[model samples]
Target: MRDIPVLFNNKDECCGCAACYSICPQRAITMSEDEMGFEYPIIDKTKCVCCSICIKTCPVKINAL
Candidate 1:
């Protein structure tokens, strides 16, 4: 994919659950730390295929429904 598969409008939207990282078929997702040491998923664009699987499994998105 040309862009990262996952995008959050705010930091609170993510809980660092790693569901995306664990489920990525291509292993394109990795856990990364922010300046404040909070971990989040970072997509390797080179490896990502624009799959929305991460979005489907995200707790934040699921709970929003």
Candidate 2:
């Protein structure tokens, strides 16, 4: 089976809107410090039910699945 990866966009593409985080009903998404010094989103798989809410809310094509 192919692994469903939790992808992250590079800092330049991230807008730090937290829309993905807000949309996740499982609260699996969290804001982290991007390398470029901006807040960006990361998935906490432990809390993620793989419902794909974060993927849908990513405005910058952050989701790879």
Candidate 3:
């Protein structure tokens, strides 16, 4: 698969939800613990297939254009 950019907004609005993490079939999204001990979603670009699953699963404004 080709390389794809996976970026997240760390605006503290993300509530450690696993929607994006669970929906990824390629196991691309990994949960990382923050200083507050909350699991945050981190995408592994190398493993990502550019399917945009995480973007679809994300409840936030992942893309507004």
Candidate 4:
């Protein structure tokens, strides 16, 4: 198993997009709501293969380039 990079350091860094969850090949990502009713991706490391596809699918990451 490899160390997976965190999805987002802060909530502000994420845009509540489900792209990461939709792209996970291992089905390791799930969306959970925050107290403010915002959805964020949660990674299940037990299922995650560390493929980093979720990171690659992030709109925020794409727009950063």
Best-performing candidate as measured by lDDT: 4
Instruction: Residues 1-65, candidate 2: write the lDDT tens digits.
Output: 33333545456556788888888898778788757678777877677777766666677764433
Q: Between candidates 2 and 3, name the one with more favorable lDDT.
A: 3
Per-model clash counts, in order, read 0, 0, 0, 0
Better of 2 and 4 by TM-score: 4
TM-scores of all predicted structures = 0.84, 0.67, 0.74, 0.91
RMSD of 2: 3.7
lDDT of each: 0.84, 0.70, 0.74, 0.90
Regions more than 4 Å wrong, model 2: 1-7, 62-65
Q: What lDDT score is found at residue 41 in candidate 1?
A: 90
Q: Over all chains combined, what TM-score does candidate 2 have?
A: 0.67
Q: List clashing residue pairs in candidate 2.
A: none
Candidate 3 local lDDT, residue 53: 73
lDDT of 1 by residue, 3-45 (tens): 5565467888899889988999999988999999989998888
Task: Candidate 3: list runs displaced more than 4 Å.
Answer: 1-7, 62-65
RMSD of each: 2.0, 3.7, 2.8, 1.1
Model 4 stretches with alpha carbons more than 4 Å out: none
Candidate 4 local lDDT, 4-65, one digit each (tens):
86999999889998999998999999999999999999999789988888988898988877
Worst 10 residues of 4 by lDDT: 1-10
Ranking by lDDT: 4, 1, 3, 2
Q: Which model is ahead, 2 or 4, in terms of lDDT?
A: 4
